[model samples]
Target chain A: MKLWLTCLLFACMPAWADAPTTPTDAATWLNRVAQATHQLTYQGVFVYQSQNIMAISHISHLIDNNGEISRLDALSGPPHAFLRIDGSVYCSFQNKPSGDIEHRPHHSFFPEVLPYPNTHLNNFYQVRSLGHAKIADHDCEGVLLIPRDAYRYGYALWADSTSHVLLRLIKLDAHGQTASQLTFTQIDIGHAPTRAQLSIDFNDKLPIKQSGNETEPKAVWQITNPPSGFHRVTETVMTLPDHAQPITHLVYSDGLATVSLFIERQTQPNTFHQQGLVQQGQMLLYTRPMGQYQVTAVGAVPLATLVLMADNLAPIERK
Target chain B: MSHLAYANKPHQTDGGHDYIALISAGFDGELDDQELLTMLDRHQSDINASCWQTWQLIGDTLRQSPSTHPSQLAQRVAEQLKHEPTVLAPKPLRAMHTRHMMSLAASVSVVALVSWSALHLALISPHTTQLASSAPASSHAIQIAQIDPARLASFVAAHRDFALSADSPDTDTSTQNTAEPTQ
Candidate 1:
């Protein structure tokens, strides 16, 4: 009887040791965040910090019968508003007329949210849960995504526990130093935004206009050898009102961060030129003469990233 | 705390270990007046003196303590003298064996004085060939030279995937392009 009792106790040991609560993994949590950011309605004031540059913006996102409508108004500095209706983006500056609307999917002004769900993000980044944190007065689960390779930087992401919306996003450099941080100071989840909050009403006296062709043309220029994982996503020819000639813009992305390359023909000899690389905030700019054209690659990626893109800039050859 | 915790069994027979522990205790200010006197007496012997130094060095290394000992300056002078040719003849001093201590002190002081003079001369005299500053002057330039604002704005405006800036509300509409289309 004593032996039988001991055997029974041993049988129940594993059950007693097992924990009842199971926290969500990083991938599932991230997927939920990507969904919540697009599907839900939220309004918040977020602060973006890049080195010494700190800008606060009030953002409101509403999903109506038509589609998603988001508005981001700069709270500090000169007043500026970036309003989006479905896929069209409109801009307004302080004391200036509203800018032309463009037909393109808007960028996530908030860092916590990414526009696309990168299914293969796990292949490049090893995601790990960093326990719990409180952000914007809400309990959040923080996750650190360390890059598997040097081609891209890492990210420290935090999602709201209840809604799974991203509450904070920190871009870490190759050396693990914080390159930039974007966090919401205050946020209201599931809040029905007023029409005024989601709308951008420009002054009647201010002139409003659109610039450039309606659609982006095929990319004439191509990166001969782009770094691993980076792919050219969008190519467009932009004709700014002030510039004499149109500039060719090519965008490359590694799932998360983006690099923008601008190519323009050197119409006249530049007497004064500041060439090489210039880093401002999280953006790194590398400009050099590419034969007859001046190529400038700008992005939040490492200097090596821009250099790689700049070295491989060439006109695409048609067979 | 465990390091400070006394050994359960004291092995007085182990001279080196006992002395090291006592020296460590003396350094930690746990030694009483009698124990401190005992430590001082042990410090006088050559073997114990060297052992005390080694133990102190180990403790300092473990604590990551910056060495501000005056002996460092003497060591530097000694090292400088190793490379330098003997200036003052030790031959005359070597004959007087009774004044050996005085002779050693005199030699050390002379080396120290010579090292001091060499340092002073290096600092006072300017070099004819000036190497460029290790840090480029432009790198440290505090004021960021402003490029053509219009040109920079145009480039930035054009390069932006989407128009993010509301600074210029003109027909600029490319800042939004920076954001990639959803998967």
Candidate 2:
């Protein structure tokens, strides 16, 4: 009888483990989706849509002993391609090589659309299982992340049932409208992509924009009233092209959504400044002119959230 | 010249308020010879020059003309003021018009392509299989306000770096070879 029970338990374990019966189980499934995205080698075409704008891109991701390498080519709109080897990114626009490759601290794209596990999104987002469905003829389990407050947007994620790879993601606005979406039409998981498929010639005298050598400057500005659950992540001072003065950049995140505040001294007296709010797809930018300084806050959050943070930003008075 | 005569007009007020009215009328082509000459003379003043440029930009925007950067407009206006005898003449202004029309044209084409693909995908793509419960369509329309597109694009690019931090420190760097492609 014991031998018979052992066989039955082993046979049913796969199905039992995949199904989420509680909220905690749903969170676990999300964790699995995050893990599969980075650990497995995948190549696919995904469609990104936001409001009236739509773009299709082909992405090839490879994970080997040398770390992760991904090449993304835009199949629609303007001709452009992005090659990411770990944290560094290279770009080619209109078949012309980019002059500099930017080294970012963290970067994410379509399939790799999840926050770090340590972010503990469950604190701000209520994870729930939306059951199962088929996407691109592959069975997928759906998970919904509903925001606990109005400060942040929500997300609906659908992961492959067999591999737990995220196949689709829909970002929802505060009113539950689809703010933006990314869905894979076809995917090849676990197949190693050739080196040539993930390679981009940086040997053409293209300078690498190094971020590791950048030193963190003293924090001279502070956001007095950030929205709920949002906290400062990183701050740095860097010289942007065309600007004579260095810009102070601060990054804030609520795990999923991030907001960047840029402050620069106004050197030219006649420089025309752009003020007020601007919307680009799911993102919002708010610019406010402080005394002798230009302050701008850019993020995927709502206009009110940005306004609240931008209005309350104050410079630290040094003795 | 006519400007010197208009600058000495008895009825002209010393305050910038009178020039402001003339500037507004100049945009509508309602200024008479005397008023037009007076407006041109006042255009040299720092306050009046700024006022004139703002009114011109507003008129161009209302007429659905190609959008130009405010700084660019200021530079062109300053250049015309330096070389051209008549700063407010329509011929000089029209010569420098629509410097950034190509970007606007590109934006229109991109929108058209996106609309076409969205319809095509919905009709034929197998990935349209909806999984989540359908919510009521939002009635809200996004309003594109007056802001510098180039400056906004830079901010958006910077924000993207932090927005998508997918790789976690806890993420296992070791590759998983057991999974197979679902062909």
Candidate 3:
């Protein structure tokens, strides 16, 4: 009788495992995540982990009446903070303006940034549906995203069933290990947030200053051979925080992905990191050296795309 | 999640495989004129989509370059044909006038032929025969620069049915023949 009970339990287990209370639909899931990032106004605490670094950050984001969004964050890494409004980023240090800031800006677009252009992604990646899983204590659905080619890596997303918020995002590397991970330890979605919660506190005693000098937009640096569809967006002469010599910050983009070209005075650490891709949540980073300073470009696109961009860096001096 | 999830997985929104294949074939010389034309047509949407960004990066290089090297008479002619912008000119007006041979030639891909012929007007160049093999088999097609380093490597890889982008791991250099030293 005990032997008979064991066999019955095994058969029931498979059926029981399949039976879940509910799972959120996948097709409508990504759109909900986009809505949470854009429409919902809330402050949340999140944890980010990578192969080389682990950091925690507090983000307070708000969408104002003009629909212009502002994000204030105090990232706990060597004590630096960012007050970013749209494209411009103001990096602050320990409750004070760091130094004479040379704003080297790249057009950073977020939240399905290039919405229309991605219809092409369907050709290369077969989007598959996985039932559901739990992430950050939220009952989340599982999504299996497969790459069509080896040029890029793939990802698995766990989105909250109730709120449609992305609770966990895992970026997979070539070896199938977790190259990067982003999980929300605490989250509040679809809740209204107050202005006091989102705004940064600056001491009234200090004078607020914008230390960047805008360059002439048409300062041309012609590339003899760039990859197809790319053009030189702009170039600026700026100084780095530790270095005295002004470096040339060149930026390039194709409406969707962005590549930065920084020609600075080369420093020690001559053993440069091989063209790499470091992911922290939605951001992807690729760094390479030009004539001098190491050119580090970061965006939401694939690392290979940026590596090719940097490798094909042909020199052009105002022609 | 099972590790296999990461092993063979990719984002559903990552769709540059066909494009990378097209570019590799285009550069590798593996794609025949018909194959090239078919790919160009089929990938019209994708080219404008994912591949176009990288293509834009490559196009910027093409636009600012006369990279067709070895000081070939063919490349000189192609360059002369490229710089005379004819895209904005109304066609009927040019057809009515006989003196605008440059504009008429610029309108047609055959401008490479005229400019090339003019370069070899006085010399018996051996490359003319080699160049004939380089032209698209069909009258209407996207012409791949058979000798350009960027195009040559890519064409060789593509024709061998391999992609040249980050996806494909190995490109055998033993297949490296027929291309003159680019530098």
Candidate 4:
């Protein structure tokens, strides 16, 4: 009777025994990370490594009644500070006369991965939990997002078990080797940043030059063929500092990776240049000349993707 | 305390240090009469038998100085040769006056070929470095010099606001992708 009771007790144990210490559902775990980033006030230093190059930047995020204000100071590079007040960004470089301001929709820097809508993700990626790991002195749950197709890269993300804040991220190539990695070496969460830490001190003499001016020119160009799962997120006209005319810019994203297309009318005489494909680490650049206008596509995607998108650009005829 | 210190206690035959020491000695051919007898006794234990086999393989590797077998090496060589380009014999020299004309034509052809190759290399050279650097082993400097940190900072800041607003259902409808005319 005693032996039977013991066996029954063992079999009747709670289902929580099989459940992971962290959330198993990738969407919920990722959403937790995104929520923590916006709601929590924290300060930390993160290292971005791609290939042989590594850069260290200090970030301080503060939330108040007005909105969330954050500051990023580069510790490794030359004197550079980035201050973001809600959606407006103010950047100050040691060489530049004035800090440039741009208003755009963006997200977290360290844990750049968010739970993008997973409606079509299952077809392209295989998401799984890599169990648990210790990162930056905190116990974290590792999640692996493996790409099923060759069109995209894979990612290994580690989110803090307690706070749900992302601790480490690794971008993997097709062969499963790490292509780039981002990790928070040290983090102090729950501590609010001071006013001075979140503030940007701009040059008094020079006015802030807003890039991608609100004046959005009508987009006459269209991408005839975009890869499946990608959608047009935004279309706007950006008046660059060096150029006299405004360039039409179109942004596309598949909820994970983003690609920007800049269509500029080339009017400079004797400016004929060799134009095609150029790459820097993960970012690929593709340029295609169409009559007097040059179309440049930039993204942190495969070279083939950029080439395809660049080649399929068509001018829309307006009646 | 350290695990190693705890493991070295007396009355622990399961630790297998004695058997490992004997195996090392046997591998080095330094096992004397007493050590050889000790190894023979330990060989009865299943753990020591596995360790003994591993030690034999290690001894064999050390004695032979690790290398592919001759047959395997020959197979690999043959496989490589299959991919290698074959060398053709030079054409027999032509007769006197025709040979002079042929030699002049050959010189001109060689110059044209060299110039064409050089120009082709020059055109493709810059792009090759950009692509080759993508390989993990290549030591290509990050081409982020073109990325203005100031601009990126502004974009990130702008993105923060978008993320915040996008999270809320009520305020989401307010910010439409807007485009104003350039003044």
Q: Each candidate's root-mean-square deviation in Å?
A: 17.2, 30.3, 30.6, 21.2
TM-scores for all candidates: the values are: 0.58, 0.58, 0.42, 0.55
The lDDT of each candidate is 0.59, 0.63, 0.43, 0.55
Give the local distance difference test score of model 4.
0.55
Rank ordering of all candidates by DockQ, starting from the highest = 2, 1, 4, 3
**Residue A265 CA displacement from its true place in model 1, Å:** 1.3
Worst 10 residues of 3 chain B by lDDT: B162-171
Alpha carbon lDDT of residue A153, candidate 3? 45
Q: Which of the CAPRI classes, incorrect, acceptable, medium or high, describes model 2?
A: incorrect
Better of 2 and 4 by TM-score: 2
Please tell me which model should have the higher lDDT, number 1 or number 4: 1
* lDDT score, candidate 1, position A37: 82
TM-score of 2: 0.58
The candidate that wins on DockQ is: 2
Candidate 4 DockQ, CA atoms: 0.03
* Deviation of model 4 at B22, angstroms: 42
lDDT of 2: 0.63
* Stretches > 4 Å off in candidate 4: A1-25, A93-108, A112-120, A200-214, A241-244, A268-275, A317-319, B1-183
Q: Model 4: per-residue lDDT, tens digit, A263-317?
A: 7776784243335555544556666666787777777666556666777788878
* DockQ category of candidate 1: incorrect
Residue-wise lDDT of candidate 2 within A75-186, one digit each (tens)?
8754555667756656555543222222333446668867546446777666656667898778898867776655666777888888888898887765666777888898
